[model samples]
Target: MAQKPLVLILGPAGHTGDSIVEGLLESGNYRVAGLVRPSSLTKPSTEKLRQRGVEIRAGDLKDSMADLKKHLEGVDIVVSCILAMVVLDQKDLIRAAKEVGVKRFIPCDWATPGQRGIRPMGDMKGEIRDFIVDIGLPHTFIDVGWWMQLFLPLPARSKREPEVHARVNTEYAGGTTPTALTDLRTIGRWVARIIADPRTLNHPVLICEDERTQKDAFEIGCRLSGEAESLAAKRISISAEEIESRFIKFKAASEASENPMAWEILYPYWTMAYVKSIYVMGENSIASAKKIGYLDAQALYPDMTRTTLESFAEWFYALEEPAYAHF
Candidate 1:
């Protein structure tokens, strides 16, 4: 309940990590501690964090507690948002958070699909969460919903328009609806508010804007394409069973070690969490997804207005970010 501590965010230089830090810093709600690898000190985001006056500490995530404790000295919370495909060593960081006196720690989990549908994600994040709780470390599992920008139409390299090409044929669990998706751009700031509020505690808060849904994506995409006649422009209905089946198939393909399909493993969930959640229940379920215990980000930041998928899509390609230079 007390204001968030001079929080330390492990891996604060990465995409999701930087967004979280920016939100916290910009809110003027908490000071940020940036834990990054010595090699990454020169990273664009790390340099930017330093310029913004965040306490940036360089350390190896794989190092022993003695090596990482320095960064944790005065830290209240740890927010980690590393890319999984590239980074493998998070246990040391988790152990260090426990060994040190960090009050609450937020994990890198960004996909906030419905509770029932995210079983696979939990399977991925389960051990880390349990380990933290077992060590008596207060941990917050923040599931930011799907990254909608990745949805839209597929690239020229990939022929099928996601709208036209059906990646997952499964419908919703109840066999009455198709899975829904959310705009992930809305997630970063929601995470900031969650970490800022004491009531969020150390719980899994599924972060999504109030208007999050698969329909949002369909409507917006249709509008953007100027294809009112396109089926995606109009609301379509499928069963929950179909959605669940599609997700399960998608997950099985993702878990396939023999030939891991990259997009199947990562982007589908990012594109469908909201749709899954919508089928499971509805907008009311977003609170349970975020694990507010009894609070919501909107209530916490009364002045906050979440960006809709349509607005985010327009701005997504417009950001003049230095990290990514489109050739």
Candidate 2:
């Protein structure tokens, strides 16, 4: 038999990264190697991958250039699932992949179809996408759409006040704008399919579990979580223009603060930027994807069953505490 293509995954311990790892391993089609940072070696997910017979190589993305290049040796494909904040660090990674003659480079562009200019950090990801193209390596960008996990809400109370904490409150004030969303399980399968297909090379592909307005998603979550009746009167309602204005103000405050590094200012700026990008004009997400000849997840993998918002909400609320529970 001919040699199987060797696929190397970066940041394999992360949310999306781990999903991709599980999918690829389950497929049993290629020799999979996961490049994890030293800090991630102790993680339970990393240990699980190690036990699964995945060739685990430890190296840092922020540092370790020569080591990263060394690990890329004989690797036919490189799939990146790095976080948004550290996306720029892929510049060196692209150079290394090109130097090692890696066949295809898949960068972490997994979000709404049009992430460029939507947020400052998104612009940074766009820069990395452009750099990948400029480096002369065959590449593919996967736009996985909004994550379903973000819609789940949990009730909380301070000493003085009780409130519901959900990203939908901030991101989708006027929640009834068409939004494309995908669950992590679907993204994992879609990514594995992309890795197996040669036609996906050198383009952006949009994949989602389904498309529904943000309000639809919130309603699904509320109904499943049993908070629908009580939360009906507490829905947040804000206009798109107001969201834009808030984003601008937050950006200004982040820049003007004496300690811009402080979490107080930086957190709001980041949150506002992300909210503005997704919900301010979310109807455009699918439109932009189609303008670029977008490939749908169902069309790409017909045999694969897609997750629905309601089903996701049911599963999410069933958990003792959802994955990545944030205050």
Those runs of model 1 whose alpha carbons end farther than 4 Å from true positions after fitting are 1-4, 85-88, 113-119, 151-186, 225-295, 299-302, 313-327
lDDT of 1 by residue, 179-243 (tens): 22345434556777787667778766655554444545555545654444643433345676666
Best by TM-score: 2
Task: Provide the global lDDT of candidate 1 against the true structure.
Answer: 0.60
TM-score of each: 0.70, 0.89
Worst 10 residues of 1 by lDDT: 318-327
Instruction: List clash counts for every candidate, in order.
Output: 28, 0
CA lDDT of 229 in candidate 1? 60
- Candidate 2: stretches off by over 4 Å: 62-65, 155-166, 169-173, 257-262, 323-327
